[model samples]
Target chain A: MALPGIASFLVTIGTLACIWGLLALGLNVHYGYTGLLNFGHVAFFAAGAYASAVLTMPPPEQVSQANYVIGLDLPMPLGFPVSLAVAALAGGLLALLIGSTSVRLGSHYLAIATFALAGIFEDVLVNETWLTNGTFGMNSVPKPMRETLGAGGWQVAYLAFSALCLLGVYLLLDRLIDAPFGRLLRGVRESEDAARMLGKDTNLVKLKSFAIGGAIAGFAGGLYAHFLGSVVTEQFVAGVTFVVWAAILLGGVASSSGAIVGAFLLIAFQQSTRFILTIYGWIQSVLPEPLSGVLPAIFAPLPDHPSFVPSVRFIVIGCLFVLVIRYRPEGLFGDPNEVTVMGEEE
Target chain B: MASALSQFLQAVAFGLVEASVISVGAVGLTLSYGVTRFINFAYGEFLAYGAFLAFFLSGAGAGVVGLPVAAVVAVLLVGALGVAVSRVFFRPISDRGALPLLITSIGVAFILRYLLIAGASAEARQLPVPLMRPVEVAGVGLTPLELGVVAVSVVTMLAIHLLLQRTMLGKTMRATSGNRSLAEVAGIDTDAVIRKTWFISAAAGGLAGILYGVLFAPFRPTFGFGYLIVVFAATLLGGIGRPYGAMLGAVLIGLMISLGSTYLSASYDQAYAFIALVGVLLLRPEGIRGGEF
Candidate 1:
């Protein structure tokens, strides 16, 4: 790939990292800050992606071969803003419902509940073919300014837009964490019983945190949908949810900067793994056949087609997670004090 | 109306058989959780590993008798892996918190899944075993393999019960799960109990996987990934720490899925498990048998 090509790839990955960073930040609020272990954060992401996709897709009667949901004929300016709002709203609503029922449970129960909900959402997306187009996925969902500015210009515009979104979210979340409500959330994380004794409805605060965090995730999802020019149920798998959690851990779970930094490092590491494997094929071939065969087997299944390197990326991420946990449980930017945030209730 | 009734019964039977597999899987999960006090997110991987091991072993010309040996080997291998993971990854963070361990387990799951996908062909591979010829009972047909699954599940449960009640190791495991520090103080060798727990739990999971592969006929790399949520639901529904509760919970979930699919869309089968889990949590968080949460 040329420099520009690599730049675009990096940009695409950077955009993803930013989006995940945002989501991980939201998770940081729930898991890291509040000590709530939510294993199903992707449900919100899916809700956001599906909500935006559904809202923007042209009505069934007006559907065209292009698969752009917002209809190419519609004014782009109006559609983009609506899509983002819809995503956030949908995610917030889901978080509300989930929180109302599951959040009251202990951390383990809450984690399982969220995990189940994520699976349920994926099931709905896959089985409700009429609603979200099943596994075929919604494609050509109008990239912001793609038609008018062309692909290159649109990519550049999206990169800028996504970065702005990331910065805005980072600052907002940082401010929130410093505020009274944030401190209360941390209080709840430190000691739910003490928070309860202090006349705080820890449940309500946790619910609100979950809702707001989910809304942020939704915003990221909307951005992701528009940037990728598609939304699919596959994108919302439990694997993705865990990746966000991994990123949160890698970056320093409770730190806003950690989410962003972790997302970048994790994605970069994954991409680099692929680059290394591809470049070393000649070296691999020269090794003993049995050794070579076993060596490749040690990695994730490499697809016959070159473009589908995501599976390998997942394997590397998994390995990295194990290593990170074993070596640096506090995460890259994690504070030793923050460790108590996740410790068991005494 | 008669046909509908028959269909419902058949679905229930199918669900019972399916539940047998899930019950086995859930029991393993519950046992591990009971002792470790953290959900082993990689529990499903044990099942996958077992099935794949059986797949390879059978492919290498292991016959009917070889099935049990393959299962044992897979369980032992996975148990060793579990012990290694616990020592290297889990023990380090054992005092830190659950979130890190949870993430690590999830990573282990992904690694195992991808490893299988990388080592084995992406396409679904059939176990090199003859299909159990289907037998009709009151106009509801079930394959012999399915019947074997149910029978083996019962047998396994009984064996587990006997082992837990009668054996010294089982007693030690129970003691360890009940209170690790106390068990250690009482000279139970808590670490050894934990290692044994992993071996037994993982072995049970592996057996379940092999049986599932036998009953289902073919297995895919991501098969266990798809089933993990439902299994987790069953485990939780049965209460997090009780093995028998897991078995019963799995049966209920299986029945719900089977019956729900017949009445509703097939796609909603998984949703049934989630619904059951939520219902159980709402009504009886400790599960039907009522144990430690």
Candidate 2:
């Protein structure tokens, strides 16, 4: 496959990085700040994506071909924020329900419950054909200012919009964390017993953080839908959670700017490595036979192998994760002192 | 009414088969979790590895060994592997919390799962075993292979019961789980006990894998990964860290999944498990055997 020009690639990857930055920011608030170990974060993300996609999409030309709840027929700019709000509300409500029950069960059980919930969410998306189009996904999504701006210009606008949203989320979280409410959340994470003794409603504090995080996740998902002009169920796998987690952990837990840096780093690494495969094929083609023969066909089957790319990607990421977790838990952009895990004094 | 009773009975029997499979994995999970306090998400990977290992052992021309022998070797090999992984991966970390350990296990899970996909064929492969006649008892049909799975699971559970209840090592493990620092003070080697716990846990997981692979033909490397949700549900339902509770939990979950799916759409089997899990957690957060856990 011919590679896209550098500009298109940058615009595409940069937008995704910003979107994921928003996701990492949300997770940082939940896991890093409030100490909630949510294993099934994808549920909220999927909820938001579906909410926005269904809300903004124009009805299919053939009604029999597609069916979904709402089609406001509003322009892109008008629909985007509305859909985003709807997504955030869906995410917040889901989080509130799960958090209220799961947090009371403590961290371990809460993690398992959330993981199960995520699985159920995936199943629902696949089976609820009327809603998610049964895995064909929503392709009719209107981007923010797409009609006026044209495709390339539209992408540029999305990149800017996502950056603005990321900034807003970061500032909102930074302010919240600096406030008394943030301290209460930290107290809940550091020591529940101590927080309770200090007259803080620890459960309530945790619940609040989780719901806020969920809202942010919803917003991020909605933004991604408009950016792509499409939303698919496959986009909301548990792996997405891990990828975002890796970002925040790598960038530095709890710091909002670190979330962006970490996301950029992750997306850059993945895209660059994918570029390696393209380079490999290019080299094989341009090497002019005899030199290529001398290079020893060690990767002979790699081009044809289906699992090689994803497996190698995951293996590299997993090894990096292990290494970071072991030595530099503070991450590249984070303060050394603000590791997400509690009860460990270095 | 007669048909409904028969259907219920059939569902109960099918549930028993699933419960036995779940119980094997849950025992190992609860055992290690009791001692170490980390929910080993890689336990699912252990199942995958063992199942694939058994497939490799059964002489489909490329196999290193065959069944019965393959089964025993798979169990022991996985047990040893469990200790090795814990040593290399988990033992070095000084600080312990649910998040760090949970995240690490997720990494392990990723590596093991993809490693299988990369090293071996991603296509589904069944354990090369002879076909057995289906046996009927009280209007419910059971395959000879399913009977073998039940037998193997029961034997392993019995062995675990004996090791935990009768042996000195078992007593020490119990003590360590009951109160680790106290057990260490009383001259028990907590590290050794923890290692032993991992071995037992992984071995049980392996047994479950082999049974599941053999009975449930056309399984891919992701076979165990798919059922991971159900496994966790059983472990949580039984109460984490309590083997007996895990057993009861597995039975309950298995029955619920089988009967519920039979009545409902089969596609929603995993969802049913989650529903049961949430309901139980909300109604009785402690679980039936939660106190012991």
Best by DockQ: 2
lDDT of 2 by residue, A1-346 (tens): 2235888889889988988888888888888887788877878888888888888888765345575545555566876778899999988888888788777767767778888888888999988877788788887788777778877777777788888888888888889999999888888887899999988888888889989998898888888888787888889888888888888878887778887899899998877777877787788789986788754468665544677677778877776667778888788877766674464444
Task: Tell me the whole-model lDDT of each prediction, alpha carbons only.
Answer: 0.80, 0.82
Give the per-residue lDDT digits (tens) of candidate 1, residues A210-250: 99988988888888888887888777888778888779878
lDDT of 2 by residue, B1-293 (tens): 87788889989988999889999998888899889887878889888888888878767525777687887888899899899888988887735555567778878887778887888758788888888877887778888888888888898889888988999989998999999999999999999999998898888888888878887887888777777878888888888788889899999999999998899988888798898887777777667785764
Error of 1 at B128 (Å): 2.1
Candidate 1 yields a Cα-based lDDT of: 0.80
What docking tier does model 2 reach? medium
